[model samples]
Target: MSASSGTTAHAPSRAPWLWIAALALLVIMTRLWMSSAVSWDQNEQLVWSQRLRLGYGPQPPLYTWLQWAVNLVLGPTTLAVGLVKNSLIALTFVFMLLAARQVLPERTAWLATAGLAWLPGIGWQLLRDQTHTVMLTCAIACTWWLVLRHIRSPRPLGFVWIGLAVAWGVLSKYSFVLVAVALLAAALTVPAPRRALLSRGFWLAPLVTVVLVSPHAWWVLEHWDKASGSTLDKLHPADTPSRLHGLATGSGDLLAFLLLAVLPWLLMATYTLGKFWKAPAAPAASADSKHTSSLPWVEPLLRHYAIVVVGALALMVLAGASKFDGRWIQPLLLMAPLWALSRWPQAGNNARGARRYLTACLTILVLMCAIAMLAPLRDAQRGNGDRLNWQLDAIAASLRNAGFDGHGVILAEHHTTGGVLHMLFPQAKVVVCDADDPGFHLGCAWRKAERARAKGLPLLQVSTETPAPDAWWWAAWPIGSMPECQIHNLPYRWTDPAQAQMQLEFIVYPADTSAPVSAPVAARPTLHASAHSHLQ
Candidate 1:
């Protein structure tokens, strides 16, 4: 039997591509309409994107480099961030579809790609609050696709592409090493993949990876504490009572992470396909059969996933790790849908079943979009708010009205506030004051802040909470005395009568006598009453 005999009819040649593009557009539009404020991860990325560097704290520099590039073109606005994030998300879907097509029939490939929307990590969390994780997922997907293609028909250039993808993945997140190691281990167990790996051109992969990653590697060596300290602290927490207890906790967390990341796709597939685990009857051998069998590649891919999970647990036990975040396993679990579909290719033979699965995926996408669009209104109704609802624009206006030009230095209590301020006043130097750990401070921003202070330029300190006179940041006050702060009670973006106003306090330090006074503000923007009608 042909591949199509074991799968649904081929979809229109361009239908899947069009759907992917349309889905991307819908997500981007929804995010643009949701709120202008950046989420937590977005804020961190914006702050780091102020300047390019070889490394950033905790995470690798690739995502920051991309963000900086986008900001260079788009001027550090929310739109710049949104576009970069959504594009990676769309690329992820494209890569997954391409990889699936290599191992399964065309229709099954589309279904596998659609099934990604059912995973909460990819579907909702990515849209709402993930940054580096999104980039890493895209890189992993690209790597998988390239590796599969290379395995099917080995080529020297194919190894080069895989090398580039691997380098990109590592630079996106350090955890990607686990995936890479697992892939190699699993590939060695299979004949075709093993022979392909032994090819002379395979040496090019590591050479390319090392050459591309050398600069960042040097930076990590020089700044080892800054690069790996926080991650180590998280993995080996001081509070762990004992190794035995730590292993138990870590294993449990790892299991929970896998389930949360993969269960949605698994449950949804089972519901739609009905007992897909059952093995399908083998097709009778025929001389005219033209379809390449997927079993060789699919089996190894599944083994690769298994090794990733088992290896993660083993590392946790070895390192005595006590905590695990579900997001960390994203790259490994990203291909779960493809693996599930590959197990029984005949699962897609039912036209009604395929349609039902596609419909369910689209429904999830719509629901996620709706949730994002309505998030601000929901926060307002509940009388609690996050960064999204903060009145950053109004706060910026109030600062300008206070005879403070956007030319000096701003010290913010949190990175979220600092990021927003940096975006609003791109000319000003913004430093986050809340990083108690000296290792966490971004050296570039700190140096700029100090230089601006020494020059007696406009210095402003802003915070949501009142700062004590003895606060660490106050030590650098140019005036040598504590300045009186003006407290503004600004309403959130969405209005709820019962909601309390957010408190924002700011202090402006005196400038040098030789410094020119700021020009009088013209057409100061006033805060407007919240209109709930627009959101509805």
Candidate 2:
């Protein structure tokens, strides 16, 4: 098909929005229907959402804050978490489509948006378990669209919006700083973006970002060690004999992760488009040069992205960092589809090719939805234990039978279990004994537990197994003797009664009516290595 004919055939329409909405709804419904038990990351959010705070563990507060707001209305059910997650995912697509349309033909723009479904991290991981990364993806997509729009037509108001988007990005995840800096560097390499950056209104962008990010910035300053500790641990070299060895390992890991995250879309696009890498035929004198130059932003965007990735790898090697997660590179490569299509616009000019590409993308998404829906049943049949297979309802029932009474405090060994318990018993205060920071006890749940104990309210301790004598909870609140523990082996949620069962142990410490009412301990005990290892 000719370029004009292809553009007309796949003209801009509301069809893309409908597809995005449908996908979002499907994910939200699938999650609600799958199981009530939360995944590891979702449990972490539930634990953090118990109370509002400026910072929560190593990550920023944007996601947890949003979860708190959703839970306020939805009452801490799976629907609240699913709604927060899938809504951001929907926005990610919306922003990506808007950005693509700024430079590519409308049909090609839709292709790029659909193409995101081919990326494993965005298509599967986000739908399955990711939390903070989802919010960061949405913020990054918005920032990219706003920046591209400003490049097409600079306005003071546009700069202000850019600032707001950048602020949102940083609040979503600290790694967004790298993306923001790399994007600014990339824009400077291009003439139009450079001129736009030089515009007088550009100052508003930074000003707005600083104002919006300052409150959380202060909280980070006060709790720098707690906020950055986990991230540093992940980046720390794993007992390498030499820095050179660490560098080699870290570089290889970073590259492998980047490729895995983008290769599916890249390879599929190349195969489907036939000549995805071939240079386009020369434009005729009658061709509008203005329309050709509309795609000027893609070159710098891809170039700076490469520079940033290389620079990050080099820095990680120097710091002896030997580990990387696929999600870490998600924001950097989120625009891979757009870059691929823009590099060879002619490849996308064929109407038949576009149809096949969209069909493939839709097929992959459908498969992803199917996998998500049936994963629990598959695990049950195989007798494989996973988050979905957890029998949280049975566990909660057993605890109630032991006299929990839906009041007072429940101390859980791990954050995951704590979050599930919190969801089951929303009226009671739930605390993860394993999640306490060594230097600063930021978890208000701990204090609430102490006050509840002093008030002679029921206090229950729950764990997957019996806690060791020296467990962290013992040190936090010293009990005179180990209470009578009950062990229950309940069958997995969907598994047959004959299959392997989930083991749960709990100790119900009835109300301490004998102790005199007094203020809880002024200082918390230092976190022990055993508890730390259990958390890891």
Candidate 3:
């Protein structure tokens, strides 16, 4: 064999693991630097993490429980919460590394693994949003690796891991069921992996998964509306014309988003496969022998990815899903390189292509890290009042000044404020009245607040406002309806006029149990009545 061919045939002596280590460290450091405040999703996650229940809001309890554990160790600072998410993101790449090593040579494996980190969906959306989907993404990556391991070397432990991972992924998000379906399809159709279906260990997997997720499944059964409402809300059927229109728009948008999500990897994949299509056929292997030989494990893995991604779009088109979020497929993006190289096996041996791919990924990774580091500083300097710079400390102090001693129920008109208050004052009662949950009236813990109100414990009422606010003006009535209210319009101290032209107001109402709580006093401004009507 020639020198370059020889290099492709064997693993390199020098370790590429150190490079992965450095990238992992960079991921953590960027997260810590970006961890000044929680985003809308992070703050919302805090609401779910308030307890270790089997279910929270629309999603399962695992991610929140994971956050709860992280909070226990690191405390609930933004950095600690962010670290939990960033660590999961790191594990995703690690799992990808393991999966890639199963199908390709060491150098190609490293390239594929590192390349996943730069996929716009994985690198940008997953890292920035840090949603429950992050956990699902990690679980899927692990499942892929474990499934490949079992197929490559049929072990019972691998099946156990696949079960555990699928369970974890399902617990993280219901959308993960798509990935499970993909895996099942792989097992059913692929010849070598098809043998796993008959294995006793394979049969044991579903039982293990069921046992692992039974508590949350039970919770979903008990609280169907709360658990499934958000998901169902998006799946409404459309009329024929509407469905056709949505099908065209949604498919086009989904394709665009998918392309953007996969980015340069998709481009690289297309380029590599194009070369494969153009290359002259090798006449080495006999036609019958080549046709009969077992397909590479990567083939079925790619099928799983296609079934989840393309099959999902097909179903959505059939169901008339009006819109699609690219982040929905973020978990599957890791399989892009595998799918590409599987279609064109010889492409994995292209040393020049491998170097170019790694370089592009590194460039994107560094550029993103720099942007993450600088964006917040710029926002803070501009006083944008984005979550990273939200003045939670000031809000806490304002509550104290209003005679809230971290006791009784504290009421806020918005989940953002309520969630932040809950995190800041763990002992105090924070009630958010803005939940879409049918069971929740004002917000979660409404019943708890009602009992406290009956007992006449003070309910510290607070509401925030911006200069040119939209629908948020209506939030005040629910909190304002309390009896004997004193309103304080405190200036929002978080941002400069240059950063944001918004001032937050706090209205502190003392709950007097001696008097019955009635409707808002007629003496109050007509704006209150107008706001109440809007809510109705």
Which structure among the candidates has the greatest lDDT? 2
Pairs that collide in candidate 2 are: none
Which pairs clash in the backbone of model 1?
none
Candidate 1 lDDT trough over 10 residues, lowest sum: 527-536
Residue 254 displacement in candidate 3 (angstroms): 3.0
**Worst ten in a row by lDDT for model 2:** 527-536
RMSD of 3: 5.8
lDDT of 1 by residue, 344-381 (tens): 66667778889888999999999988988887888887
Q: Rank the candidates by lDDT, best first.
A: 2, 1, 3
Please rank every candidate by TM-score, starting with the best.
Answer: 1, 2, 3
- List the candidates' TM-scores in order: 0.89, 0.88, 0.81
Residue-wise lDDT of candidate 3 within 1-536, one digit each (tens)?
Answer: 12233234444534556666677688677766664556676766666676688887788788889888887776666766677777787788788878876665555567677777557667774347567878888888898888866766776777778789889999988888888887777677766677755566777678789999998999999999889877666554344357668778777767887777666777755553345535542223321122211235456657665766677666776777766676676566668776655445455467777667777777777887888777666776766655555556655665676567776676665666666777677776666655343333343445555666677776665555432122232333345553333333332233455436323444444467676555654434543332311100
Candidate 2: list runs displaced more than 4 Å.
1-11, 281-293, 435-449, 465-470, 476-479, 511-536
Q: If both were scored by lDDT, which would come out higher, candidate 1 or candidate 3? A: 1
**Model 2 agreement with the true structure over 1-536: per-residue lDDT tens digits:** 22444233444689999999998888888888888778778888998998998888788898999999999999988788889988998899999999887767677888888899888768866447779888888998899899988877788999999999999999999989988988888888877788887797889999999998898999999999889988987877457777777778788888887788789998888667675666663333222223532455565566676687668666866777877777887666788887777665555577888889999988888888888888899999987766778777777788887778888888777777888888889998877767343421444435655676778888877776333233444443545444445567677867775766766766676776685433333222322211211110
Q: How many Å off is the CA of 439 in candidate 1?
A: 6.6
Question: Which scores greater on TM-score, model 1 or model 3?
Answer: 1
Question: Relative to the unseen true structure, what is the C-alpha lDDT of residue 214 in candidate 3, on a scale of 0 to 100?
Answer: 93
Residue 317 of model 3, lDDT score? 62
